[model samples]
Target: MLEAQSRHGRTVLTTLCVLALLACNRPPEIQHDAVFGPSHGAVGDTLWFSARALDPDGDSVGVRVAWGADDTSGWTGFDVPGKLESLSYVWHDDGYRIVTAQARDIRGALSNWSLGRGVSIGVAPVRPEPPIGPGYVQLDREYAFRAVSRDTSGHERRLRYVFDWGRGKLDTAAVSYPSGDTVIHRHTWRTPGTYEVRVKAITDRVGIPSAWSEPRRVLVDSALGSLIWQYVLGAEVHSSPALDEERGLLYVGCDDFRLYAVTTAGGPVWQFVTSGRVRTTPAVAPDGAVVFGSDDETLYCVGPDGLLRWRHGLADKPGPAPALGPGGAVAIGDESGRIHVRAPDAGEWRSYRTGGRVRCGPAFGADGTVYAGSDDRLLYALTPACSLLWSYPATGRIRGSPAIGAGGTVHFGCDDGAFYAVAPDGGFRWRYKAGGDINCSPAIGADGTVYVGSDDRWFYALDSSGRVRWRFKSDGRIKSSPALGDNGEILFGADGGSFCVLNGWGDLMWDYDAGNDIQTGPVVGSDSTVYLAGTDGRLHALRTGCRLATDAPWPMYRHDARRSARAGGPH
Candidate 1:
């Protein structure tokens, strides 16, 4: 029994030895490799760090990562041998950040941290320069606007520029790294006015804006000179004035039975007396002589100095102004249904009789064909020799003179409230029906759109197909013809005593009050000044520049009698 008990004790001892050996061989321990990453980066830059770890017993492992800048990511677990663990952290301030990592075994045994990777985050200090402006820029002209920025932290970076044009326009510009702090931009103003501009700088990386620069006032002046002066006459001036741009002279007839030659400065150059009211706009001869008809049934010619040159008695009162034909021949229409052709010496060349009263001036075609509209509802295409080429019958009395288009299309309006586009050979191209009697003539625009006003108190723009493109309504009947401005603007006066300016799309741009009915159309000067006459006997000059009809001299009625073609304004 003692031998058996000893043997049982030895067996138990052997079992204890086996359990101790198993306890000594515990779960795998983990070892970490050196940590590595970039040393420095800008603030807000993401820093990436990498570390290598392994489990000694080839067991699954977990890693804890810590960024010394008060940032940490939770533990991550992995089972692969010699696996790399990576973590990225963004720095928000300027400071040194150390990244360290430790490994843990499946048995919860943890190793010391690996070598730390140090990263320095920096913020570049900056000062913004004040924005500079041209101070005085001409309207419609592009000028340079500039701003600058300085980096005081000795670090290179990209920057963004924001410019406030003060005209309800904001602009942004960017400069890449290695570019100078100074930046230049360009802008233009559409109208003559005063504005203020400012600018600021922002970091492209962080989108942080610096202080705005000081404000700069910019003065924009009209490229077209402003209103110099105005001249008031004795009676209402219904006559559309003529401008002699070379001589800076302006001529107009008045209801007081007088003709006056005024300088562009609004001073009277000369005055002539007529026996009756001068309703006709005067035509300037090649020799600078003025020829016009009067209600006294007399066609008078006066020198540029306002001296009487000659006078011819007509059978009836002349309704339409005279037109100058090739070789200085003057064509005048009287209510007697006769177109009296006079030579430069004031001698009659021919008097062609029509079926109806001739009430409109003549417009010549490119082929020298004379066009005249009559109360008999006919538009006669006559040769310069007083022979009729063809007569196109209209729906109503053709009181408005014809305007020649670029493609030889003749555009005119009649009392029947229809605007007609007749071919050069007097063939009907198209007809546009308006809301009222078409008393004023039609003006051809640069885009081949026909502009005309009707007694129905509406202004219309018609395409070549006679389709209405756009229309604007006025308060009163529009008897005054519309004029083109240098900037694609439409100018006309309404019987309601309102002169309105419309943009290319028939949008109202501006307006003025004349206090009295405006029977005469406005004329634009070379410098973009608008000259308008009113029944109040006062002529007003306003600075409203346009880009249309710049090369035209009194485009509508009186200035150039050769043809009613208006050259487009500045492009």
Candidate 2:
């Protein structure tokens, strides 16, 4: 009985030993080079890596991936042994990094790490520099902006740019450019307001975006008329004002026998005294010279500093403002029925005698051909050399200056109460008769709409074909020419000191009573300020919050704020 009991105990001990051996866990095993992932990546990139492992006891296993010493993915969900497990990790820094992986079984036993995979993490492009562009722009005008950036990854990569136009608008380039290259983009603002523009760069391949650049603030004006300030001169300002945009100065002739140079801000800069009434509008040359005709029977040229540069004597008192042509040529008409023209860099004055006094400023065609009106009832086209090109006879004397429109059509009003459109080659396009003499020059709009004023006290808007579109009645006879605002608003003055603003549909926007007749038309500045000359002896600067319609061929009297009298150029 003792021997049998001893054998049973040995058997039980042996069974217990076998059960303990079975319960002991063996850690999951991974191949020495089983970890795999991309060899290169950019910062902030989410990279995937796969690792395979096997458990000796056929237990489920989980994988853990470490992108760096500080970045790690905690254990993943358990899966079957010998399965390839994929885990994702993001690197915040740039440089060479080693990725590693390990495995664990359900029994909580960890295995040795697999061979590390070498990944060369790249850096994204640097933030772009602040956009470079104009500080002030007219509303609805397209402007250009530039952005630049560089990549520090030491790799030849392309970068794309994105622009934020501050108006909750964003634009991305259609294609990428080389790193450190400048990217140009254009944007237009429809509304008037201050806007901040910003930009950013991104790697084209990895799509890693850099920080945004510093913002550039831009001011946009509506350019519609509101009173900013008014400067009263010594006498009536029948002469239109000229703007020297580069110097921020305005030059205008006053009946007080003085040529005034005022700042655009309404402060008096300087005034040049004349011997006779200075009734002609001033013209600015590219070299910062101001030229105008005075009843003193002299055409004077003054420097930007208000000093007289030179003066040329005329046959008789100059009746209208001088027109500046290409290369500093000056053309003016005198009461002696002579049109005097001086060539650039020449000392001699060339003259062409008309049958009657030349009372209006001459307009220039694209090729430098000059168009002038005479009291003899003729519209004469002359060459820059003062030789007649062609003459279109009118029923009565032509008093107003002529305006050139698209396709070289010349528009002018007649003392016989008729408005005519003459073709470029001296052929008549059409004629529209008014109830009274049409004495104001025509302003051509972008769509070929012609705006003019008549002695009948009416402001007329006609289509390109000389058909009346609409007409607005004024308090007195209309004589002042029309100027166009950027938003298609028309501005004109009349005999009763009335300056009115009208929209494209002929509805009145507003009006200002200058207390005296406004014979000269209004001039618009880049900031949309309107400079109106009134017989009240004041130059009114109205902040219309509207810009000039640069697209219009003839937006104002004598062409532009400088009274250039040249066609096919910027307003």
Candidate 3:
């Protein structure tokens, strides 16, 4: 018994000594490499980089490339999709700024120090100078737009242009002009309106912006520039469709003017119809009511049971589509140049008038101002109470709708073959000229870049300052607005029934053709489905690339009863 106790004590001491030695010799783990980038960029712009790290063991390992930006502050990073490759970024903003990048290997390690190769990013690229101009044009009796001049620096300033119509603007690009100056040589617009167009002449040899030009007015026609299409409601069907998300079902409208609900991945479940052409896009109200407008000029609120709860009408036929605003008010324009704002229940409807036909829909600014165009060659800025605030003139008919962005920057295209940017106070910022008419609406990214299509068979990406970053030529005229993905992919349709995806830099990612003209805008749903209505009478729910299958039917984005093929909503 004495020997056994002694042996046990000796074993315990030996184990304790071994542990102490191991603890003293062990080293700390190394940190992973990191990458950083500009959270905002044009489609083809480079991502910035920064590499910082440390190894507790005093030994370092190289970092593997990852995804885009990693945080809300700017751009973040993620794991590389496949092959191991180094990544970089560039800045479109002025001045040099520091950005951080995170890198890693198969081992789950992290880095803190933003120093070393591939760890810390360098400063952004220099801004390309604006184009030069002594060019100008008169759009109509009310306004005249022109391109004055620019500064040449950075890359290459190539082109310049102006619009003085229903929608007015200045044009610029990073390309050289005839005078051997780096300038935005060609700029165009469709409608003429109010503007203050300017360009900073630039080139790789000469850098920075030059003196600005005085403001100008652009004229536009109210009727000719607008694009309207005939719509056919189901002669074989009767009911309106309810977009049921969770069930992947599309409630059908029947030929008997009744409703039919069906599964998206499956088939029809049920449907109900109205007394007239169910040409209206159904609105799922806050109270679970499926409200919609009709050719009968009556607005009806229906229960989930397909029962009508309440109905209202415009004093006359609402010749235009409706805009359902924040408060429960229904807004629509008429053929007689009148705009009606009404409550859900029947009562005296408020009306506002313009100088021409209210063919285009009304857009509400953040301050409750109403913007609508007319055949009278004017773009009227109106008060919420139906009073005219300001009127911008145009050269051709003002048919295009307007898109408002940060700081009240307005974007729209016109038949005058020009794209225009306007300030909140009804002044012009700039414009770009294209070879063809512009019927497409504009899409604004979080970074303030604007994307739009034109009848000139081209799609363009413009920077915040109205400079053309890049342009992609298409086989057919682009009448649709682009649908932007969370990952920065641009999805859109063409007049030739083609669907395509554009990378951040205006490069063609991929495309698909459905064998019919797709005049509707593509909508990106939460379930990753893309919805589009084609002239072939088919509603498509596809992946961003237009190859994957979808589960919904009606993808019309209009908030009113007129879900026509006309280019009204933002595509």
Candidate 4:
């Protein structure tokens, strides 16, 4: 009887030990209704669901998720107790789905399932419509483009857009818009070429991207200058162009507040932006640096690579184009009536105050003398050191730059409606009266013939003594200066958009209608091509079959094709 009692006691002791061990360990506890996810998602879209759980014994926990009745994910990697755990799932079919999650401790003790979450899965959004914009565009000018998309699943969703500008440029919208809404974007092209603009859409909730829209072809033109090719700029061009023969590039400024460097092929090479209108003609230095001034009261020097080499601040807006001097020095005049000269090597600058605003570009004599025309109706001469030499008075404002003749005579025009010749020593030589204001600079021929245009609508050829040899009538006022061709022909533009060429005998060789006001003068290229800027915002290149006059003194507006404003002849 004692042996039987011992056996029963052992069984009782084993049962009590098992109950104590079960009481010591606890299963993980999931928070009530803690499952979270988007309420709506597209079919085949990856959706994420999360849940939070806690282990009563401070053990790590892992989460297991179930979608509807058929799909269930294995437990995820363990996370700290009381932390949220997430899993991603893709539903192939559209339906109202219920998602729930459960948690388990490292010891494999599982928790009860959290409250279920419902999601309405549907089809993805449709591809966006192709972008709509101008088929042709001018370089560096911004234009508006638009696109639209819709959710084919009939769901109300916010959509985001992405744009490909075709030139390896891509942009994504920062904010999403409601589905089927037209999205507008602004873009600018810096280089000249053909581009394909395209767009795509993405749904904000489903995070699924739609297919890219059909591409829209856009032909971007440089618009900076053409018969071979024409480039269009952002605004009208009043500034003349300077050619770099070695690089086959042309530099010009525009009222659009930018300096553009374009290839002879009429393609954009690069651009330098300024804060103000760039009305001053660019001057090319011997070392390939381009110098110009802006109405922002500053002068900029850019290198051949379209990078800024340096810039100088001025007290007032520059009134005229910059002039390149010996050893890379530059000279420019300002509305404040100051002539600033910057030394090439030292980068140091010196200024000389004038009696009035200098509206005409300064010219350099063979002897290193600087001559500038001012609104004060005086032509002032100075040395390279900025020291005053002499001043010749005029009846009206001296608006045109001066041209130095082979005989050391200075020729220029005045608002007095007369073209004057001044001796090198500041003495008056003679003046030939015109019908209206003389605002255009003079160009000298090898045989000592002086050519200039007047606001009176006539271009005149004068002998060395200021005697009118002959005159040619134009369709409109002649404000554009004359450039000489290698064949002894004079080429200039008039206000009526007429680009005319005349032989030395004052006979019209030919004329081309530019379809706009030709305010800027023509510059002859080495290959005899002519470049002219107009108020129409195009640089027109004409194959004139005549080269620049190499032997003539002051052949073009600024003395040479480079617009260096230096006398003697082409460098």
Model 4 residue pairs with clashes: 223-231, 223-232, 223-233, 224-231, 224-232, 225-539
Question: Who is ahead in TM-score, 3 or 4?
Answer: 4
Backbone clash tally (model 4):
6
Clashes of each: 11, 11, 159, 6
The lDDT, on a scale of 0 to 1, for candidate 3 is 0.50
lDDT of 2 by residue, 231-268 (tens): 98998788888888889999989888999999999999
The best candidate in terms of lDDT:
2
Cα-based RMSD of the predictions, in order? 15.1, 12.9, 21.4, 23.7
Candidate 1 residue-wise lDDT at 565: 27
CA lDDT, every prediction?
A: 0.72, 0.84, 0.50, 0.84
lDDT of 3 at 165: 20
Sum up the clashes in candidate 3. 159
- Best-matching candidate per TM-score: 1
Runs in model 3 deviating more than 4 A are 1-266, 269-284, 288-292, 298-306, 309-311, 314-320, 343-348, 545-571
> Candidate 4's residue-wise lDDT over 1-571, tens digit each?
1122254454355666666766787999777756888887778878998888898898899999889858899988888987878789998987688898888988778888888898877776788777876555557767677899887766677898899999679999989999888888778888888999999887775665688999988777763223665789889889888888888999999999999999887899998999999999898987788999999999998999999998999989996688877766678899999988876564678888988988888888877788888988889898777888999988888889888999678999998797899999999899889999988888998888999998889999999888999999999999898998875678999997999877666766557788888877788898767888888789878767677888887788899888998876354
Q: Give the TM-score of candidate 1.
A: 0.63
Residue by residue across 286-346, what tens digits does model 3's lDDT show?
4445555555656666766667887777444443335544445556665677767654343
The predicted structure with the larger lDDT, 1 or 3, is 1
* C-alpha TM-scores of all predictions: 0.63, 0.62, 0.51, 0.60
Sort by lDDT, best first: what order?
2, 4, 1, 3
- Tens digit per residue, CA lDDT, model 1, 1-571: 1122255454355666666655664443334456767776657767787666677667677776788856677777765647777777777776666778877766666767777777666664354555654454467767666677754445555677888888778888755433255677778788778888888766555454556777788768763334457799878787877766667778888889898888878898878888888888777765678888899999898887888988888889896677766565667788999877654344457778887898887766656677788888888887767787899989999888778777788888999898899887778799988878987777776677888899999999888789998899998999888887644578899996798887656766557777788877677676666777887778777766553363432345432421222222111
